[model samples]
Target: MKLIAKWVLSASALLFVAYVYNGVEVRSFATAMGAALVIGLLNAVVRPVLVVLTLPVTVLTLGLFLFVINALMFWAASALLDGFVVRSFLAALIGSLLYTAIGMVIDSALERLLVKK
Candidate 1:
């Protein structure tokens, strides 16, 4: 139940990102849902490996390089999906930041709503 809620909210967040930023475009709600799932999968499966491989650069940049990795993941998801488009690396960066912020809110809300105290 919680997972489904998170997925739905994540999709909505994607649509919100598209609506707010001209650089990122989501074609429809279904497309946004698909893109959200792909992004989640990439973040779950690939992002850790990327973080490990880029540890040196990440450390050198004092953790700021993680933002680049996040943008890459965001861009990669757009590349894999037909209906979701990120215009450029800069767009990916801004879109990812917005999505991440929305995701954090979703997570916090879900935790409060679903977890028993």
Candidate 2:
């Protein structure tokens, strides 16, 4: 259930990005679903590798480098899907930051509205 909630949160984040940023492009639900799959896969598969590879730098950055890994996953997802496009690394970085913010917001709201019930 938590996993499904997370996926829905991520899809909502993608939709929000599509709406707010000119640099983000979502062609259709098919593409969006593909992009979301890739994004989730990359985060799950690549992120731990990246975190270990950059462990020293991550420690140096006081653990904030996780955000960089997250951004790279977003950029990679953009590359994999034509409809879901991020214009550049910087845009991807910003989009990822936005994703975190939106996901947290959605999670909190879900907890309040659903779990409280």
- TM-scores, in order shown? 0.97, 0.84
Provide the RMSD of all predictions against the true structure, rounded to 1 decimal.
1.0, 1.9
* lDDT (C-alpha) at residue 14 in model 1: 98
* 1-117 per-residue lDDT for model 1 (tens digits): 789999999999999999999999999999999999999999999999999999999999999999999999999999999989999999999999999999999999989887765
* TM-score, cand. 1 vs. native: 0.97
Backbone N/Cα/C clashes per model: 0, 0
By TM-score, the best candidate is 1
- Candidate 2: count the clashes: 0
Error of 1 at 101 (Å): 0.4
